[model samples]
Target: MKKIIPYIFLISVVSCQYFEKEVPSEQELMEKQMKEINWKEVDEYPSVADCEAISDETLRKQCFFEFLASTIQQKLSVDTLSVLYPELDTIEVRVTINPDASMQFEPQFPKDTVAYDTIKIDSILRVKLVDFPKVNPAIKRGIPVKTQFVLPVIIKTEK
Candidate 1:
């Protein structure tokens, strides 16, 4: 019985050590507070010079709004979806160009970014959809919502 008593006491001491709780360090607390204080900036819309360049009044207006909407959607997608659903393999984007006009899409990722994919601009200058697996869910939801922008292409003069 005496031997068992010592063993029990030792066991209790070892178990207590294993159950010790961890306290947050001052540096960690400061970092957390800083993160909470930092505010994210709101995105800006395209400038007026962008609007004036569109030769077709109607297309210009449509394009102007569309561009702004698209930018917002892209930002949201990157911010929300990427964190929530990593399994989402890809995102698709569609572009449409008028019969008399030609257009191209330029996708830019960060400098250190490793993912590489080719964007094919349709012969008719319309993109049906683009799929980006790395996109954020917030931005993905915005994809269906479209903003119209005006196209600045001038009419051709034929003799």
Candidate 2:
């Protein structure tokens, strides 16, 4: 009975720690994980079929950007942009790629820009930039994520 009493007391003291310490709630655990994740950058950039097999991250990104730039240049060349707006040699476009492998584009114009040129340029872009090849969406932590970025496209590749 004496030995049993000591064992019981030792067990009671040790068990007290279990009650004092917290097992984190689901929300708390989730919040901690979210904080630990890198939100500023994606694990993989969006890619086309041409860039899919590239193993090096930097090269893969370069290939994708180059492909997009050349495609844009080719498409825009068919438009009468030079005849309509000869002075406008370059434009910045905001491109958004969704997780579902869809895309959207909008021209980024300066605040002081004239409405007439903006309207014309926008229409030209909409008409010219269509029927692009499918793009695999960016990935973050093994999950597809939406990404948006501004690209400076040279309106006149000859220049």
Candidate 3:
């Protein structure tokens, strides 16, 4: 029994050395933490007032798009200049919704089209955006954030 006790103690001390966990270096820890941060996902999507009640994220996004398009169409339909411009083909507009619900617009038109006054387009868009329904800004880590969307506006000429 005395011999067995000394052998068990030796085994335990050796086993504990192997079981000890090695502390990660500072750089390794930082790299691991950086990998945990996700840049692609937002905690909540930007939503119009009408879409705020939706629970599903995909549906909420779809609802927001529909609401935005409908609102823009409704407001723009009243402005003849917006729909009809000389030699205007199709333009892509970048719309950014700020955390405070204000909007910034940037329009891109093809070079092949006839030159048009950008100031007029900017003013029209500004006025239309003022009438847009208030939106809940996107949330990243529980903080409201500005979100941008690129929308295509097609201009159709009468035959």
Winning candidate number (TM-score): 2
Ranking according to TM-score, highest score first: 2, 3, 1
Query: Who wins the lDDT comparison?
Result: 2
lDDT of 1 by residue, 98-141 (tens): 22232233333346744432322121112322331222111112
TM-score of 2: 0.84
> TM-score of every model?
0.22, 0.84, 0.79
Cα lDDT, model 1, residue 86: 42
Error of 1 at 96 (Å): 27
| Model 1 misplaced regions, further than 4 Å | 30-159
* TM-score attained by model 3: 0.79
In each prediction, how many residue pairs overlap at the backbone (N, C-alpha, C within less than 3 A)?
37, 0, 0
Off-target runs (Cα >4 Å) in candidate 3 are 25-30, 82-90, 111-113, 154-159
Q: Write the per-residue lDDT of candidate 2 for residues 18-107, one digit (tens) a residue.
A: 889778999999999999988999999999999999999999999998888889878998778876777878888888999999888799
What's model 3's overall lDDT? 0.75
**Model 1 clashing-pair count:** 37
**Can you rank all candidates by lDDT, best first?**
2, 3, 1
TM-score winner, 1 or 3: 3
Poorest 10 consecutive residues of model 3 by lDDT? 81-90
